[model samples]
Target: MEMFGKTLCVTFDDLVGSGVMSKANYKRYVREEKFSFMQRGGNGRKVLIIYDKLPDKIRTEIDTKNPGAKDKIKKQQINPMDHRLKSDSKAVEFYKKYTPKISLDRQTEYVLNVKVLNAMVALEVSMRDAQGKCGFQNNKEIREKVIALCENLRERYRHTLPKARLMEKYAAYKKYGYAVLVNGNSGNQSARKVGPMEGRLLLKLKRSKFPVYTDMQIFEEFNRIVEERNARATREEDKLKPIASPQTVINYLYKTSIKLWWYGVVHGEIAFKNEFMPQFDTKLPDMPNTLWYGDGTKLNLYYKEYDKKQKRMVARTIDVYEVMDACTEVFLGYSFGAENFLTQYDAYRMALETWKVKPYEIVTDNQGGHKKPEAQYFFKRICHLHKTTIRTTASPKPSKALSDASRCR
Candidate 1:
């Protein structure tokens, strides 16, 4: 017999349309013979016999035309033990072994049903436990405990009971406060409310009765209050004002010790009384031509000087002496000097020449330059010849003349 060209094993429906296989005797033929059939438009609609195994004669014909055709066809033969075929066979085997065994005892059947129901409950409980202690909450110990607990239940009941059924029993027992599992859950407590003392303090502050103080000041006062309370045998039941320390009061008033010292000096006020303090408040003696205030002061020369090295340097010294009217603080006359006492006589002469009316009094300090023979000769001889009275005053304590000059400035 001649073989068809490259025969393909196709279902009858694939060739003659799907429903055509169900019509007439086609389904019967396929089921009975275990055969697949194909229809192709060849030699007036011939039916080709497509088999699981081809006849050896036709195989030989195919091999003659294509040398490797026989080996290819033999290799394509489906093996009973192949993985895909074996998987389907195993599934069928499992179903036969574990499918409902009918005609058993009704009580046995009911027990099995209860076990299955418990198994489902246990599974749900196990999942809930895991979710409750998930590592997503960042608690490693809790998650491990949960996993270990579930696994232990599985291992303990592995022989006669399902893991799910045991977990259900375990959870039910735990719900009744059995010691099956130790709970590691923790909770935070609510914070306590403020006490009466704090509330009272806040109320006082709100009412503006409490003095406004800086943090340091408040801390200092708190310490002082604590010390005072500790020293007392009986605690005072009244609200106490914060005691101020001498040092603290001084610091709060003047800010620094140096500032306090400066204030006392400039205002002529003493922290403690002195003899002169009382003397300053007393009256002074009255004497004509008995006292005079004289002073020497230096001035800045706004010029440069030249050195002996033939380099230019400005002269930088100018000094002045002044005589003043004691009663009126009037500037009598003044003289400038590069060297001291060079213009002392000139200063005196200027004073005499400029006085609108000359007084009998000529008073000055007892400096040797002022009382020198030349100075004395001029004052005594010239003033006596002109009938001008002269007298000298002794220097007072702390040189009131200099103090007065500084004050004038």
Candidate 2:
């Protein structure tokens, strides 16, 4: 049978007994030099056939009769469990395809790391060869050396690498170069089960906000569509889609590409901007009183006050609009009321009256009252009336500063 491109021979007596050739015909062929053999050493008149020199028909017969020989040789040659061993070209392909794409510096570092590891393995193998203990056959001494080396490596790397496993890796490193040491899972997308058709259907279902589909709801709806299509299909190949789990649909929704596309559509545009948009650093003024921050918030504490119209004590929480020095975070002015433009106007008036000077800039959020044309007009006229230059208005652009200021207690 074939073993590493070499074939082992069958004996003449076995071939004759198997009825591949008659004993008389074998003798005649031998006499005519049609085939060749060698007399078995110290065995009188016994002969062995050279398999490579045999006719194709005889070789085929021998292989069919002794099918287990190739398997036995392969088992002896290499371990069946070592699946990570790959060809040289495959190792190079994996390294190039899986290396980190975050940046050039990171990719270079990763390649260097793999090269260093592979170099160490090469050094160890070279040392073993120099000591005449690198044989991988049924050699007890070499096996012991390899096992002891594996124990030290196991402690160093915290991995349970057996001798056979180490040798298998060494073999690959010798043949495949440093790329064999690179991890194969860096860009692996083999686990993603959702196909194109299913992805399209999922996105289509996701875009529907009438019922605002949950992951499970979307999966169920997808299943219903697939089933409907399959029921109407006349041929098996015409079936609409494959079966997918609810988690698969959920995973697709959470993917970066899908989230970027659908977040604004599902929630409001403002929410999507807050989550995915980048924020610029707001530089603070150098000195105190140069810049002031203003925002409105509800005070949690409730107070009971007498109401003349109701003839009873009414309990309610009040909204407080406050202004603070951006440099010192010191509160300068505040006004309490049911939230409205009047409270914001009163708060700015209080700040100017308390500070005795208007700030260079006052930043406030675009709340309902803050953006009112009347309120904007009031701000423009107030500081000019006070004989001090001022800037006070809501920013036209969306910003995290507004969201942060609105959370003020």
Candidate 3:
């Protein structure tokens, strides 16, 4: 017999085991020296024959008997669950389980400022649907009710809500609401309406009770208020405001103004009127070589001197003095010394010899050495010989003279 369109053959042992051909038939076949047989194909019956090796003629006979057996084998059906569909609903379930819910209180405050609660609601619905959860599709009525609640909160608290805080709240609400709705059961009927406190309402409280608060101070206060408020209540109706008075504002303004004025007075302007204003009515007559500016400054200093005998060191100080032409800004004379009048006279003599110029006036600050009677007499005699005059400023403002020289340079 044949099944599945394939010829069937069974061994002698197989025939005995299946109780088809008996032992006598098997023995008879063995004595005849023939071990193979063929059975016709029929209803659910498989025929078996025995052969040491299939002969070419038998193989050809089998192929001829079953024309389309290979095609039948290729056409078998596979199990449906074996292949994975990429766009399956499993991803939606995974996200719904892990994503966080938004704070309702925060969202309500945000809606108050933006006045776009309906758009926020729509966004929430869309996000939920994308998560593979049945969105706000319970009915049009429920959606409208939720949207209306957002609008009501906005209307009631619009004045109290800060624009920036409200915006942050809106974002939080949108995110959390979407997560909650996606994972929550619609039929459980917990009044799909979430309140403001549940939404994590953020407070953009005023920077301070005083008007003079800095940005950092204001932010600190705002954070403090938000944390405090959150700790007390999760409901909008339970929220409280810290009181402030007008007197506080006035006091802050007054104090800030006084501080600013004091700062300006301490750090500003210290210059001669003549130095700043060139067109001042009181102008001094030009003195040419008659007047000069003299000052002393440190070039570089040595604190210790090498000791050759002891192979050690000793301390000493050095000072330098120079007289400059007030108009020409030329260095008239300079001296290095630990002594006074002698150095001054030597520097003067060097100036005359080097520049071949004589000064009509000698101007010097009232240092003990320069103001000595002997020095003054020497300067007067020098000025007389040069046909110049002597003049001196009451105080030495070297910085002003230096600035003038720099501008000319």
Q: Spell out the clash pairs found in candidate 1.
A: 304-313, 304-314, 305-313, 305-314, 306-312, 306-313
- Give each model a TM-score: 0.23, 0.37, 0.25
Write model 3 residue lDDT over 1-409, tens digit each, in one string. 2212123343333445555457886678656856554432247434345332345654454446555643453343111111111232432443333323224544333233333433445544654464333112434433444444444555554524334454455555455332222323322223332222321111111211334454345434534564576577767655533213222222232354222322222223333223332443523336656555566666587688887987888875788877777667778888897437877787787777787767776666556387777887777766653212234222232233223322111
**Across residues 1-409, which tens digit of lDDT does each residue of candidate 1 receive?**
1123334443343323533234455545555764544443355555555633444553344445556644455454321211111113332332233212212333233333333334434444554565454212323443344445445434543323334555555455445221111121211111112223322332222222245554355436544654564466254543333323222232233344223323333333443133122333423236422333455677665567777776767577778877665566668777887324556666666766887445444555555376566766666643432222243222222223323322111
**Which ranges in model 2 have alpha carbons more than 4 Å from their true place?**
1-197, 204-228, 234-254, 261-275, 279-283, 297-312, 316-320, 381-409
Count the clashes in each prediction: 6, 0, 23
Best of the two (1, 3) by lDDT: 3
Question: Which scores higher on TM-score, 2 or 3?
Answer: 2
Q: Runs in model 3 with CA error above 4 Å?
A: 1-290, 301-304, 307-317, 384-409
When superposed on Cα atoms, how far off is each prediction in RMSD? 41.7, 28.6, 31.8
Q: Model 1's lDDT to the true fold?
A: 0.41
Which candidate ranks first by TM-score, i.e. highest?
Answer: 2
- Would you list the rank order by lDDT, best first? 2, 3, 1
Query: What are the per-residue Cα lDDT tens digits for candidate 2 across 67-134?
Result: 67646765653322221222244334444554232244434544543443344454455545644431
lDDT of each: 0.41, 0.60, 0.45
Model 1 lDDT at residue 53: 49
